[model samples]
Every structure is written in structure tokens, then in C-alpha cells.
Target chain A: MTVQTWTYILVGITFALYIGIAIWSRAGSTKEFYVAGGGVSPLANGMATAADWMSAASFISMAGIIAFAGYDGSVYLMGWTGGYVLLALLLAPYLRKFGKFTVPDFIGDRYYSKTARIVAVFCALIVSFTYVAGQMRGVGLVFSRFLEVDINTGVIIGMIIVLFYAVLGGMKGITYTQVAQYCVLIFAFMVPAIFISIQMTGNPIPQLGMGSTLNDGSGMYLLDKLDGLSTELGFNEYTDGSKSVTDVFMITLALMVGTAGLPHVIVRFFTVKRVKDARKSAGWALLLIAILYTTAPAVSVFARTNMINTVSDQEYASMPAWFKTWEKTKLITFEDKNGDGKIQYVADAKQNELTVDNDIMVLANPEIANLPSWVIALVAAGALAAALSTAAGLLLVISASVSHDLIKKVFKPDISEKGELLAARLSAVVAVVIAGYFGINPPGFVAAVVALAFGLAAASFFPAIVLGIFYKKMNKEGAIAGMVIGISLMIFYMLKFKFGIFDGGKSAVAGLQKDWWFGISPEGFGSIAMLVNFVVSIVILQFTPAPPEDVQEIVEDIRIPSGAGQAVDH
Target chain B: MSDKQKKASAYWRENVRYLFLLLSIWFAVSYGAGILFKEALDTIQIGGFKLGFWFAQQGAIYVFVILIFVYVRLMNKLDKKYGYNE
Candidate 1:
């Protein structure tokens, strides 16, 4: 059967399964909507959390990005995973002990101030929207490539699917659906990787295969061969990094902090039954995530080597069928520069006639190696599962923040549970539409926007939540001031450096990197902003009176893990 | 302070100590070996992998998973020791 037929069968079955789960798990009350009735088992929550955490960026773009960045990509490998350490140790259990439905609930209640909650709500929205936009775009990309649908149409289909599960079943439906998604995505990612690993190095394990000798009878290590091939094509050795050590350090720190702070990820802990479960679930989530994370770099190496060998300096007419298929999608193009039909996949921009989108490396890997059509089709289903699961999680966060934090908590404190549930569903629909618009007309590359989301979360949420939990003296005045300053500084730096808004717009962004603050890129500037938040909060706290005695008591209460009741609504 | 309060504080202190120790290991592996000392460690290779590169891309991740599980065990034991276990 053709790849498209297999894709239709697989994608259709997965979507049907997700919808079935949503129908079966329809949330009946606000508790179910927000925290899945606060009774999710640790193992199930762990699977759901893993699916929620690994977005399109991790599933689709990361390996491709790493292939191009080479050793410099270690920032993502270390930065993204290491954050789970922060989440598991510093945040998850305590937050679970606090027993809240949303991040703003802790901030508002702990600080004993409405302003602090509002600031948290604002940051949550910004962070979630940026992150979700990337997920929607990922959905659109998969649909457009595999199903031959327009990107906008794909986004609309995605929005409808997410809206169905999210509005109907809320966290309950999303949780069970995500468990299914985790299975689909992990299975899909590993099958091709293992296939390619065995084919390339005669080893079944991708992680070990990456270090083993090539199977071509050359008796050369895979990395050694890749490095040799890379330099021969005027590229840096694949094992060496070109980014400055300081930048890599700061960027890694920012991503780690940000991952710990992301509202959607942190909120997943609220669904579990106990503080101990929260801690255990974080372990399971990271372990599940590591299965894919550890294998990504190895896949990048395999795909990069395969791509360079197949297309570099090869005649365009003899290019494989997958090349032609991808070419029609406009993701891979060859201009036949120098009046020759040979493809020049080179380091120099002026002479390089082929432009391949980073996404193609993973999406086309199975086809490049002549893997069966079913395997290729499975990747499509997996990418959709990944993109949709994360999109639903972020959408839930956005909707919950608006419905629970703003409307229910602040604007209409007397709103009914039924009214609040309605508001949540309505907010989700609006959020999905906005997200689909961004997907159809993306602001930038999916990964870059997602990285900035992490930076935003790191800058604003991490410090406030940490201080709120760890320090009984963390007053509302201090927390509010710190969050405002930290988020504002991060936004200013991102606009100036990432978008070049201050220097005349997107065109100036290229030249603005040289003027980065202290040589820190906008992506890494979160660490600096987070530092400022900690300092500003501490300084402000010295002048302000300590938090009221009751608030301090609440802090002491959360520190103990024995009696973490169901996530409280009021 | 009451006996309960004292016990809670003791548990908190122990948790902080564990966090400090485990996080130090986390930092040493990822930030230390993976980035700062990567070049120096690249001089040494394991199998077909450079030590630093392996840490950056592979080794650090394995260690992170282990560290979290370690923290989970320590925290659970501390809860039981302090009579906070459910």
C-alpha cells in the first residue's frame, strides 16, 4: 500500500481512539475539568505528563535542529532534560502539597494578594500561547505534508479535535488521551530510529549504535565518519561546538529553569492524589521522556550522515522519489545554480543550491532509507499525537487561567460551578481559534517561539513560585515587583534582540546578535532576568513587612507532605 | 516550638540538604562536564564517544533520571522518619 493510505489508516485510528477516550472521560464538574477529579494514578499521570511535556518541538524539530547545530545542540539535550531535576526536587511535590488547581491559585493564595495572582495569570497566558502556537503549527505541518491538505485546513482540523476533547472532558479527557498519545508517539519515534540504527551500525540500540563502528565495512566509528564527512564538505566537525561556553551555559540554565516553571507542566502535578505520587510521577515522566530524548541525538547523526551522502554533489534528476515528494511540498528545493543539475548541499550560502527545511530530516528519514511505507505513515500519526497532546495541555492551562483565575476568582467571585465550567469551555474555544490563526500565519519558526516561551516562564514564573513556596517571608509586594520587572525585562530583550523591534524590525535582527547583552542571546537572557527577579524580590522584602502569620502558616503547612488533600477549588 | 513543629522543621532541613546534594551532582554533570570542561574532557574518548560530548548529549540525561528517582526515595524515607508519611 502507498504511504498515504497507511497514514490515513493510522491517523484515522489514532484520532478515533482519542475521541473515544474523550467521550468516555467527559468531565462532569469543575474538579474533573481542572484536575481530573484529583484522583489520577501516579503511573497514568506520569504518562500523561510525558505526552503533555514533549511538544512538536521535541518530537519533530529537535533532531533536525540538532543535526544542523551539531555539538552546539547539547544545550537543548542538557537544558531540556535537566529541568526535570528542578521540577522533581524543587517544585513538584511542594506544589502538589499546596493542592491547587492552577499555578495562579498558589501565587494568589500564598502571597495573599490579588495583584500577584493577576500577574501570574498574565504570564501564564503569554507563555502558554507562545508554546501552543508552536504545537498548532506542528499539527499543520504534519497534515500538510502527509495528508496533502493546506496548512490552514490542517490547523482548523486540529483546533476542532482539541476543542472537542478539551471542552468536553477537560483535564480528565486530555489525560487519558495523552496516555494514548504517549504510546503512539514513543512507539512511532523508536521504531524508525531502531530500524535506521540497525541498518547503519548493525546495532539495535540507537544510543549505543551512535558510538559503534559503521556497518559499511569501513571499520570507522559513526561519529568519526560523520566528522570526517562534515569537514570534507567545509562544515565544522560534528563533535565540536561553535557556540561560546558562556552562552551555552546560560541558555542551558534558562531552558532548565523555564521547563520547571511552565504552567502546563507544573499544573500536571495537581492531578495526582498525593505529594509522594507527585514526586514519583515526575520520575516516571522524565524516564519516559528520556527514552526519546536520549535517542534524538543519535537519530540526528544518522539522518545527517544519510542526507549528506545521498544528495550532496549528486545529480538532481537521479534524486530519490522521497526527494521529489518533499520537493513538491516546497520544504526541500534545488535551484540548479551554476547551470548544472547537481545538488550543492554546502556550507556556503552563495553557492548552496539546495535548501532543505530542518523538519524534513525526521519526516523523510524512513523514506530516505527505504523503510516500509507503514513506518513512514506511523511517524505522521506520532507527530500529530505529539502536537495535539501538547496543544490540548496548553489550551487547558490558558482556559483554566482565564476561567478560574480571572473570571471566577477575580471578576466574578460569586460565579457558579456550572457557570465556571461554561466559561472554561468558551475560553478554550477562543484560545484554540487564536492558536490556529498563529499556526496558519506563524510568527516565526516553531522551535524559536517555543524556546522564548520557556524563557518567559523562566523569567517570570520560576522565581515567584519558588519564593512563594520556599520563603515564608516572601511578601506580595516583593513577589509582585519581582515578577513585573523580570517579565518586562525579558520581553524588552526578546523584542529588541529576537524581533529587533527596537532597532527597526525583523531585518535588523540578524545584525543585532553582535550587540547582545553581555554576549547572552535573547534565549539565554532568561537566566539574567531570573537573577534580577530574585534580587529585586529579596531587596523589596527587606523594606516590606513579612507576610501575615496565617500566610506563613500556610507555607509551613505545604512543607509537610502527609496530608495533601484533593486539589482545592476554593 | 511544639514537638510537631520541630519535627516538621527537621524534615524540611533534611529535604533541603538532599536537594542541595543532588542538585550539586546535577550541575556538575551537565554544566560542568557538558559545557565548561567539555573541551578538556574531549581529549578522552569512551568507545566511539568523546567523554564530554557523551555527557552533554547522553550521560547527563541518564544521570538526571537517576537523580530524580534518588530524590523521590530520600523524600519518601524522610516523610516516614518524621511521621509525615500517609
Candidate 2:
């Protein structure tokens, strides 16, 4: 069968499975909608959280990013996975013991101020929305690129599928759906990686294969060959680091704290049955996520090596079929500026005539390796699964924040459960539409915006949540002041550097070195802002009145596992 | 403070100390071996790759998974010790 035909069959089966799960496990109450009735087993919840966390960025774009960036890409590898360690250790179980439906529920109650809740709600919306828009675009881009459909049609179809599950079963439906998605995406991701790994390296395991010699017995190591190829082509050594050590450190820090702080991921812990289950489930989630995170670097190496061996310095007249196909999509362009018959891939942009989009490396890798057509189709299904699963999770967070946190908890405390559920679904529809709009007509910032979401979460929510958990003295005034200052500084810095605002094309500022503060870009500035948050909160706590006795009691309460309440009982 | 509160505080202190111990390992592997000392570590090869590059991209992730499980085991023991087990 044609690759397109196979994609339809595989993707159709997965879509039907998700809708089936949604209808079968439809949420019956606000409790179910918000936290899957808190009945999910730790292992199941772990899979769901794993699916929710590994978005299109992780599945489709990460290896491509790593392929180009070399060792610098390790920032993403360590930053993302390491953050789970922080989450599992510092936050997850305590939050589960705290027994909350949403992140704001903890923040608002911990600070003992409705104003604090409002501030948290504001942050949640900002983080979720900014993050969701990118997921929506990923959904649309995958559909249009692979399914032979227009971008808008792809986004609307995506919205409908998400609306069905998210609006119907809420977290309950999304949970089971994500479990299925985790299976599909992981299976799909590993197959091609395994094939490519075997094709190049003698080993079957991609991890060991990355550090193994070539299958053809070239006598040279894979990394050694790649380094030689990279330098021959006038590029940095593939094994050598790319970014400055300091920038890599800061970026990794931002991603770590940011992942821990993300509302969508944090909310997943609230699904499992017990405090112990929460801890176990976080471990499970990381083990599951590591399956992909570890495989990604290996895939990056394979794809990079394959491209160089197949394309570079080869005659343009004999350009491969996959290269021609991608060139038609404008993702790969060959200028042949030197008019040399041979294609040259090099570091110098002008000197190198062939420019291939990094995003295409993973999607094109299977084809480049002359793999079977079905593997190509399987990749499409995997990309869709990754994009849709994360989109569904993010949409639920947005919906719950609206219906539960803002409307039911704050504005209309008297609203009925039925009314709140209806509001949640309605808000989800609105959110999907707004997200779809952004996906269809994405701003210039859409690409970098997910990283911005991380920065925002790192600067604002991580400090607030961590302090609220550990520090008994964390009061409303201090929490509020910290969030306001931390988030404001991050926004201002992002505006100054990323969007090129504030300074209006002016050269450099007081604390900045070459338009960057300490050579840290907006993406890495979150770690610094989080530091400022800790310092500011501590300073303010010295002046503000201590939290009430009960608030202190809550801190001590979450510190243990007893009296965690009937978290799994219906 | 009451007797139970005092015990809980001690348990909490031990828990915090354990967290520091684990996090220190986490920091050392990712930030230390991965980034700062990556060049020096690169001089040493592990199989086909540099030790530092391996830590940055693959080794650290593997360690992260291990650490989380270790924390889970330690905390469960702590929970039992504190009579906080479910």
C-alpha cells in the first residue's frame, strides 16, 4: 500500500480508539471531570502523564533539533527529564497529600487569600494558553504536511477530536486516551529508531548503538566518523559542545524548573489514588519518558550520519528521491550557488548551496534510510498522537482553570455541579477555537513561544508552588509579591530581547553583555528570575505577618503520608 | 511542640536531608559532569562516545530515572518510620 494509504488506516484506528475511550469512560461528575474521580492506578496514571508530557516537540522536533545542534541539544535532554526528578521529589506527593484539583487550588488556599488564587489563575491561563497555541499549530502542521489536507481543516478536525474526549470524559477520558496515545507514540517512535539503528550500527539497542561501531565494520566508531564528517564539511565537531557552558547550564535550569512548574503536568499527579501512588507514579512516568528521551539522542546521531553519508558532496544530478520530495514542499532547497554539480553541506550559509529544514530530519529519516513505506506512515500517526495528546491535556487545564478555578470557585460559588461541568465543556470549546485560530494564523512568535511558556512558568509558578509546599511562613503578601516581580521581570526581559521591544533596537543595557544579560537569552533568564523570586519572597516575608495557624498546619499536613484522605475512593 | 509534632519535625528534617543528598547527585551528574567539565570528560571515551557528551544527553536521563525510584523507596521507608503509611 501507498504510505499515504497506510497513514490513513493507522491514524484512523488510533482516532477511533481515543473516541471509543472517551465515550466509554465519560465523566459523570465534577470530581471525575477534574481529577478522573481520583481512581487511576499509579502505573496507568504514569503512562497518561508520560503521554501528556511528551508533546510534538519531543516526538517530531527534538531529534531534528539535536541533529543540528550537536551536544548543545543535551540541554533539552537533561533539562526536561531532570525536572521530573524535581517534580517527583519536591512537589508531586506533597501536592497529592494536599489534595487539590488544580494548581491554583493549592496556591490560593496555601496563601489563604482569594487574591492569591486570582493571581495563580492568571498565571495558569497565561502558561497554558501560550503553551496550547503551539500544540495546536503542531497538530495542524502535521495534518497538513502528512495527511494531504489544508492546515485549517487539520486544526478543526483536531479541535473536534479533542473536544469529544476532553469535553465528554474530561480528565477521565483524557487519561485513558493518553494511555492509548502513549502506547501508539512510543511504539511508532521506537520502530523507525530501531530500524535505523540496526541499519547503521551492529547493535539493536539505539542507546548502545549510538556508541557502537558501524555495521559495515568500517573500524571507526560512529561518533568518531560523525566528528570527522562534521569537520570535513566545515561544521563544529558533532561530539563537541555547541553553546557556552554557562548558557547551557542556565537553559537546562529553566527547563528543569519549568517542567516541574507546568500546570498541565503538575495536575496529572492529582489523578492517582494515594500519596505513595503519586511518588511511585512519578517514577513510572520518568521511566516511561526516558524510553524516548534516551532514544532521541541516538536517533539524532543516526539521522545526521545518514544525511551526510547519503547527500553531502554527492552529485546534484543524482539527488535522492526523498530530497526531491522535500524540496517540492520548500523544506529543502538547493541553490547550487557555486554551480558545482556536487552538493556541499557546510557551516557557511553562502558557501553551502543546500539548505534543509531541521524539522524535516526526523520525518524524512525513515525515507532517507530506504525503510519500508509503512514506517513512514507510522511516523505520521505517531506525530499526530503526540500533538493531539498534549493538546488534549493542555485544553483540559485551560477548561478547568476557567470553569473550576475562576467561575465555580471564585465568581459563582453557588453554581451547580451540572452548570460547572457545562461551563467546563463550553470553555474547552472556546479554548480549542482560540488555540486553533492561533494555529492557523500563528504569530511570528509561535515557534519560540513554548520555550517562553517554560520561562514564564519557571519564573512565576515554580517558586510559588515550592515555597507554598515547604515554607510554613509563606504568606499571601510574599507569594503575591514574588509572583508579580518574577513574572514581570521575565516578561520585560523577553520583550526586550526576544521580541526586540523595550530597548527599540538599542545596543546593550546596563546588566547585559551584547543585548543579553550575562549572555543569557530570554529562554534561560527564567532561572535568574526564579532566584529573584526566592530572594524577594524571603525579603517580603520578613516584613509581612506570618501565615495563620491553620495554613501552617496544612504545610505540616502535606509533609507526611497519613490522613491523606480517601483519594481513590469513589 | 507536642511529642508527635516533634517526631514529625525530625522525620521532616531527615527527609529534607535525603532530598539534598539526592539532588546533590542530580546536580553533579547533569551540571557538573555534563556541562562544566564536559571538555575534560570528553578526553575520556566511553565506548564510541565522549563521557561528558554521554552524560549530557543519555547518562543523565538514565540517572534521573534511577534517582526518582531511589527517592520513592527511601520516602516509603520514611513514611513507615513516621507512621504515615497509607
Candidate 3:
């Protein structure tokens, strides 16, 4: 069969599996809908959490980014994984002990104010929506390239598929489906990696191969050769640091804090039965995540080396079929700026007329390597699985925030369970549709805002949740004020430098290019914003009324592991 | 305070201590070797890769996975000691 036929078969089988799981695990009550009835085993929950957290960003784009950025890419590798440490140690167990379905539930009840819950609900919606928009766009991007569907039509199809399962099974459906997705995606990712690793370095393990000698008779080390090639092309050393030390420090910190505080991931811990399971589940999630996270760098190195060898100094007419195919797709382009027939991939923009989008590095790697048609098909399915799994998780967070947190808890306390569940499902439909629309006609700066979603969460939620768990004296006023100040600062900085809003919307300035505060970009500013949040909360708490006695009692209870009462169905 | 409260407090204190120990290792491997002292560490080589690069992209992640399991074990034992184990 042809490659397109294989792609259809693979994606079809996976979607069918997800829909089947959704039907079997259809949520019976709000408990099942929200937290899978709090019965998921640690291992399965771990797999689901890994799938929910990885997203299309990690699956499709991370290796591509790493391929070009070289050692500077370590920030993503460390930041994304290291956050689980903070989650497992500082946050997850306590949140599970709190026995709640959503992050907003914790803030609302713990702060003992409907106003606080409302504030948290707003934050959750904003963070989740920003994140889901990226996932929807990812789905559209994959479908358009492989399935021959228009980006908008692909988004509508994705929305319909998600609406069917998510509206029916809610968190339960999403969880089981994610577990299946994790398996498919990891397998798909590893197959091509193993083939390439062996082909290049005579080692099947990509991680070791990354640090191993090349199979080529030159006896040169892989990284050493990559470094030599990079310098020859006017690029920074592939294995040495290029980014500012301070910026790397801050970006990694921001991503870590943001990962811990994301509502979708934190809510995964709510599915397990006991506090100990929350701790164990975190370990499971990280281990599963590490499988892909570690392999990504190896993939990066492989793609980089392969690409440099294939195109650099090679005649544009004699370039490989993959090159021509990608060129047709406009993912890879060559302009003989110097009137040389040979395509030169170099760091100098004037002579370097070969433009390759970083995102294509991962997607096109299989084709570039001449891998079988089945392997390419598997990758298409894996990308879809990654996008869909994350979109489903994010939509649930939006649904729960609107129906359970805002509408039921804050606005109408008298709503029946049946009414609330219907509300949750209905809101999920609306949320998925809205996310789909944004995926098609992605709003101006949606990509920019997506970058800041982590910053916003890191700035806003991480400190609030951490303090609520650890600080007994944290009053509602301090939490609310800190969240506001934290998120606002992040947005203001992103606009000022990234979009040039502060400079009359020129979007570029002569002298203002490198004029960042302490050399910190908007991506790195979250760690600073988070620190400010902590300080603001503490200083304000000194004068504010202390948390109520019952709130302190609840905090004390969450601190212990013994009586993690079964998650309440409500 | 009750005797049980004292025991629970001690357990909590021990848990925090273990976290401190493990997280210190975490910081040393990633932020320390991967960034601050990367140049110093790069003078050393592992297989074909620079030691610092290995730590950044590979070693730190391995250590993080190990650290979580260690924390899990410590917390579980602490829970059992304080009569908080399920």
C-alpha cells in the first residue's frame, strides 16, 4: 500500500481506539467525569499524565527546536522535566489529600472565599484556553500536511472527535485515552530514533549513541564532529553554551514552576485514590515523560547531523528527494543568493539562502532518513494523538472551571448534581468549539500568548498553590493580590519587549533590541514575577486578617497522609 | 499539643529534610553542572560528548527520575513511622 493509505489506516485505528475507550469508560457522575471516580491506579495515571503533559509541543516541535538551538535547548529538557520534582515533592501529595477535582476547587475552598474561587476560575480558564489553542493549531498543522485537509476543516474534524468523547467521558475518557496515546506516541517516537541511532553510530540506544563514536571510519566523536561542523558554518558550538547563563537559569525556572502549576497536570493527581498514590503517580509520570524527553535530544543530534551532511555544500539540483518534497511544501527553501548552484546551509543570512523551519526537523526526519512508509505513517498518528490528548485534558479543565467552579459553586449553589454534570458536558462542547475556532483563525499573537501561558501559570498559580499548602497564615487577600500582580507583570513585559507595544507598535526599535531588564526576556521573567508574588503575598499577609481557624485545620489535615478521605463525588 | 501532633510534626520535618537533601542534588546536577560550571565540566569528556552537555541533556534527567523514587521511599517510610501509612 501507499504511504497515504498507511497513514489513513494508522490514524483511523488510533481514533477508533480512543472512541472505544470513551464509550467503555463513560462517566456516570460528576466524580467520574471530573476525576475518574478517583480510582485510577498509579501506573495508568502516570501514563495518562505523561500524555496529557507532553502535548504536540513536545512530541512534534521540541526535537526540532533542539536540533537547531544545540546546547541552548537544554533549557527545555531541564525545565519541563524538573517541574515534576516540585510537583511530586511540594504540591501533588497535598493537593490529592485535599481531595478535590480541580485546582480552582483547592483555591476556593482553602481560601474560604467565593471571590477567591472566582478569581482562580478566571485564571484557569485563561491558562487552559491559551494552551489548548496551541494544541488545536498543532492538530490542524498535522492534518493539513498529511491528510490533505484544509487547516480549518482539520480543526473542525478534531473538534467533533474531541466533543464526542470529552462530552461523554469527561476526565475518565480522557485519562484512559491518554494512556493508550502515551503507548502509541512513545512507540512511534522510539522506532525512528532507534533506526537512525544505529545507522549513524552503530548503537541502538539513542542516548548512548549521542555520546558515542560515529560509525563513520573517521573515529571522530559525534558531538565533536557536530561542534566542528557548526563552527565551520558560522554557528555556535553544538555542545557548548551559547545563551546567556542568567536567561537560561530564568527560563528553566519559569518552565518548571509553570509545569507544576498547570491545572490540567495537577488535576491528574486528583485521579488516584490516596495521597501516597499521588506521590507514586508523580514518579510514574516523570519516568514515562523522561523516556521521550531523553530521546528528544538524541533525535535532535541525529536530525542536525543528517541535515548538515545531506544539504550543505551539495548542489541544489542534486539534493535528496526529501529536500525537494519539503521545498515543495515550503518547509525547506533554497535561493541561490550568491548565484551558486550548490545549496549552502550556513549561519550567515546573506549567503545562507536555505531556509528550513525548525518544526520540520522532526516531522521530515523519517523521510529524510528513507525510513519505511509505515514508520512515516506511525509518526502522523503519533502527532495527532499528542495534540488530541492534550486538547482533551485542557478542555476538561475549561469545562470544570465554567460549570463546577463558577456556575455551580460560586454562582448557583443550589444546582443539582444532574444539572451540574450537564453543565460540565455542555461547557466542554462550547470550549472545544471555541478552541477549534482559534486553531483556524488563530488570534493575533496567539503564538506569543501561548509562550506566556507558562509564564502566566508560573507567575500566577505556582506561588498561590504553594503558599496555600505550606503557609497557614496566607489570607485570601494576599493570594488574590499576588496573583493579579504576578500575571499583570508577565503580560506587561511580554508586550513591552516581544511585541514592542511600549514603543508605539513599531514592533522593532533601533536601540531597544537588547535593552531587556537584567537581560531577561519575557520567557525568563516569570521566575522574577513568581519571586515578586511570594514577596507580595508575605508582605501583605503581615497586615491582613489571618486565615480562619477552619482553614488552618484543613491545611493541617492535608499535611498528614493518613486520612486522605476518598475524593468527594461533588 | 498531643503526642500524636508532635510525632506528625517530626515526620513532616523529616520529610522536608529529605526533600532538601534530594533537591540539593537536583540543583547541583542540572543548574550547577548543566549551566554555571558547564565550561569547567566541559574540560572532561564522557564517551564522545562533553560532560556538561551530557549532564544538561541526559544526566540531569536520569538523576531527576532517581530523586523522585528516593523521595517516594523516604516519605513512605516516614508515613509508616508516624502511623500515617495507609
The most accurate candidate by DockQ is: 1
Q: Model 3: per-residue lDDT, tens digit, A1-570? A: 767889989999999999999999999899999999998999999999999999989999999999999989999999999999999999999999999889999998988988888888888998999999999998888888778778888888889888999999999999999999999999989999999999999999999889889998889988889999999999999997678999999999998899999999999999999999999999999999999999999999999999999889988889877787677668788899888798888999888979998878878999888899899889989998999999999999999999999888888989998999999999999999899889999987776777688898999999999999888789999998898899888888888877888787744743465898998878889999999999998988989999999999898889998778679766
Instruction: Show model 3 residue runs off by greater than 4 Å.
Output: A509-511
- State in Å the error of residue A226, model 1: 0.5
lDDT on C-alpha atoms for all candidate structures: 0.94, 0.90, 0.90
Better of 1 and 2 by lDDT: 1
A354: Cα error in model 3, Å: 0.8
**Clash pairs for candidate 3:** none
Can you write out model 1's per-residue Cα lDDT over A1-570, one digit (the tens) per residue? Answer: 999999999999999999999999999999999999999999999999999999888999899989988999999999899999999998999999999899999999999999999999999999999899989988999999999998899999999999999999999999999999999999999999999999999999999999999999999999999999889888899999888899999999999999999999999999999999999999999999999999999999999999999999898889999999999999998898797889888888899898889888889999998999999999999999999999999999999999999999999999999999999999999999999999988966556767888889999999998998888899999999999999999999998998888899889999998999899999899999999999999999999999999999999999999889898767
DockQ of each: 0.94, 0.91, 0.88
Where's the lowest-lDDT run of ten residues in candidate 3 chain A? Answer: A504-513
Native contacts kept, each candidate: 0.91, 0.95, 0.86
lDDT of 2 by residue, A1-570 (tens): 888889899989999999999999999988899899987999999999999999989998999999999998998999999999999999999999988789999898899988889989899999988888888877887787778798889888988898889989999999999999999999999999999899898688999999999988677899999999999998999988667888999999999999999999999999887899999999999999999999999999999999988888899889778888788778899887888788888898878888888778889999999999899999989988999999999999999899988998899999998899899989988998898899888886887778888889999999998999888888889999999999999998887887766655434434454768898978899999999998899999999899999999989988977777644322
- Which residue window of length 10 is worst by lDDT in model 2 chain A? A504-513
